[model samples]
Target: MLIGIPKEIKNHEYRVGMVPASVRELIENNHEVIIETNAGIGIGFSDQDYIAAGASIEDTAAAIFAKADMIVKVKEPLAVERAMLRQGQILFTYLHLAPDLPQTLDLIDSKAICIAYETVIDTQGRLPLLAPMSEVAGRMAIQAGAQTLEKSNQGSGMLLGGVPGVAPAKVVIIGGGMVGNNAAQMAVGLGADVTILDRNIDTLRSLNIQFGSKVKVIYSTLDVLEAEVLAADLVIGAVLIPGAAAPKLVTRDHISKMKPGSAIVDVAIDQGGCFETSHATTHQDPTYIVDEVVHYCVANMPGAVAKTSTFALNNATLPYIIKLANLGYKKALENDQGLLEGLNVINGKLTCKSVAEAHNLPYVTAKTALAI
Candidate 1:
């Protein structure tokens, strides 16, 4: 099989799909790997590194796409790259299709096999591919929010880790999943008061047991969410629903209820934010004021740390990529249930139930889609 790695073209996106070591692994498995020129540069891997690893480098994305059977990417295809997709080709990437009707339609029309990394599930019912990036984004949310809280940034001029005789900031996290957990860990480590809310009672119990009174775990009801937001100095929106759009937990009215100059870091902005006022911002310009409340909702938060993110992402995705390349997507899906769950759109049909439901399209089970 011929595998292609293209340079990520999203605004402020610097992570590459594959690194030199991963290419070497593919070569060892007897697969031909093709990388577009300087594809690994953002991640600090040079073209010479890939060449030394026995991989071929192409000068253009068109050249790489023309010959490769499978295309591995770090992010969803942009408009220009979407136009370059070919029928019967394999696209393995993080395709958050719920929010973008145009991109979803384009993928279907292209008649390509689209396996979304975010939708893949492990036996433990955990999102393995999405977890790594979520961990990165979650930790960074606090760092970004703390920066935005400085008076220079139009924030409340409060310090996250306050000095003696000064009160520490109140940090409220909206979910108890991977993103929220990491964010809470960071906030608590900085000596701030942290509260995490979730709809799952059992998960909340687990969190309470794990944290052991260090942080507050509350049952997430509208009233509880409102109360927490009203008193919070930093609000981190970490809600996620896999392939579906993130449910809006913070409404415009809620934003108005927040204290003046408080900061909201919506980590779910990529899947349509959990805040009513949150829009996809770039790392260059990552904040906006809504009702005097600052919103930092950069869709690709991990992109800010290109080298770390690329290596972390590659570590999690390489095994699956190897399976897909060696056995072919169909055979690999047939062999591993985890890999089967990654199938979103294949040959122009919608396979992920959440994605199809999000757009009112016909739905097919992942099992049924793989059989085709």
Candidate 2:
């Protein structure tokens, strides 16, 4: 099998799909890997690095897309890249399709085998592929929020960890999952008053045990969420709903009621965001004010830290990529139920129930689709 790696083209996206080490692993398995010229340059891997690992470097994305059996990418293919997708070709990447109707439509029309890294699950029912980036985003959320809170950035001019005789800023996280956990870790480390809200009692209990009174774990209800948001100096929207759009837990009314100059870091912006005023912003211009509340909704938060993110992502995705290349998508997916869950679109059919339901499209089970 021929695996292709193309340079990510998203705005300010610097992470590469495959690193030199990952390419070497494929080569050791007797697979041919072709990477577009300068694909890994953003992450400090030179073309010579890939060549040293026995990868053939192509000069253009068109050639890589056209000739490769499977396309491995860090982010979802952009509009131009999506246009190049052929029927039956494999696309392995993060496809946040629920919130992006146009991308979903394009993928459906391309008739490609789209396996979303974010949707893949492990035996423990954890999102293994999405974990690394989620962890990065979660940690970065606090950093972004802290920066946004500076007075020059139109924020409340409050330090996350206040000095002696000054009370620390209140940090409220909207979920108790991976993103929330990491955010809480950062917030608590900085001596802020940290609180996490979630509907899952088990998760809340787990958090309570993990922090042991350092962080407050609250049962999330609408009233409780609103109250927490209103009191927070920095609100981190870390909610997720797998392949579905993130629920808008913080409404416009809530934002309006928030303290002036407070900041919101919507880490769930990739899944359409948990905040009603959230819109996907780029690193170039990462924040916007809504009702005097600063909104930091950079959709690709992990991209800002390219080298670490690329390596971490490659660690989690390489095994699955190897499986797909060696056994083919059908056999590899059939062998692993979790991998099958990654199959969102195959042969022009939407195989993800959440994605199909999001757009009112017909849903086909992965098994049924593959069987055909």
Candidate 3:
């Protein structure tokens, strides 16, 4: 099998798909790995590193795509990259198709075997490929929120931890999942009064056990969210709905009630955001004022730390890439239920229910699609 690794071309996306170690693994399996020239440079891996790992460096993406059977990538294909996709070729990447109709249409038209990393699930109901990036984005959510709190950034000139005579800032997190947990951990460590709300009582109970007196766990009702936003100096929206779009829990009307200068970092922006006013922003201009409320909704927060993100993402995705490469898409998906969940589209048919439902397209089960 011939595998290709392309440099991520999304705006400000510096994370590459495969690391040197990943290339070495494929080489050890007797698979040929081709990496586009300068693909790993943004993530601090030199082309020489890949060459040392037995990967041949191609001068152009077109060259890599032309010969490789499977293509691994960090992000969903952008318009230009989408145009390069070949029919029946395998694309293994974070294809968040629910919110992007154009991307879904492009994949369908290209007739590629699109296995979305975000949709792949383990038996534990956890997204294996999406977890590493989620962890990075979750931790960074707090770091980004902290920076946006500075007065110059238009946030309520408040310190997260506050000084001796002053009260600490209020930090409200919208979900109790991985992103929310990490954000809350950071907010609590900074000595801010932290409150985490979730629709799941079990999750809230778990958080209560973990944080004890340091973090407050609350039932996430509309009234509760509104009241919390009114007092919060920093709000982190960490809600998710797997492969589907995130529910807008915070509305523009709710934003109107939030205190002026309060900051909101919507970590769920990749899944179309849980905040009504949210739009995909780039790292260059990450924040905007909505009713005087600061919104940090960069779609690719992990891209800001490309080196760490690339390594972490490869740690999770490399094994799956090898499976698809070794067995081919059908045999691999047929054997592993978890991998089957990753199949958004195969040879132009929509195989993932969430993605098909998102666009009202005909849904085909992976079993049926693979049979063809």
TM-score for each candidate, following the candidate numbering:
0.98, 0.99, 0.98
lDDT of 2: 0.95
**lDDT by residue for model 2 over 1-372, one digit each (tens)?**
999998899999999999999999999999999999999888888999999999999999999999999999988889999999999999999999999999999999999999999999999999999999999999999999999999999999999999999999999999999999999999999999999999999999999999998999999988999899999999999999999999898999999999999999999998999999999999999999999999999999999999999999999999999999999999999999999999999998899999888889898899999999
Give the clashing residue pairs of candidate 3, or none. Answer: none
Q: Compare candidates 2 and 3 on lDDT and give the better one.
A: 2
- For model 2, what is the error of residue 177's alpha carbon versus the real structure, in angstroms, after optimal superposition? 0.4
After superposing all C-alphas onto the true structure, candidate 1 shows an RMSD in angstroms of 1.0
* lDDT at residue 70 of model 3 (Cα atoms): 92
- In order, the Cα lDDT scores of the candidates are 0.92, 0.95, 0.91
Candidate 1: where are CA atoms >4 Å away?
A: none
Q: Per-residue lDDT tens digits of candidate 1, residues 1-372?
A: 999999998988999998898999999999999999999888688899999998999999998888989999999998888888899899999999999889999998888999999989999989999999999999999999999999999999999989999999999999999999999889988988899999999879988988878899999998999999999999999999989999998999999989999999999999999999999999989999999999999999999999899889999999999999989888898998987888988888888888888899997887887677
**Would you give me the overall lDDT of model 1?**
0.92
Which has the higher TM-score value, candidate number 1 or candidate number 2? Answer: 2
Question: Over the stretch 1-372, how does candidate 3's per-residue lDDT look in tens digits?
Answer: 999988788889999989999899999999999999999999788999999999999999888888889999989989888888899899999999999989998998899999999989998989888888888998899889988999999998898998899999999999999888988888888889999999999999999999999999999888898999888989999998988989899999989888999999999998899999999899999999999999999999999999999889999998898898888888899999998988988788888788778789897898898899
Worst 10 contiguous positions by lDDT, candidate 1 = 363-372
Please state every model's RMSD to the true fold in angstroms.
1.0, 0.6, 1.0
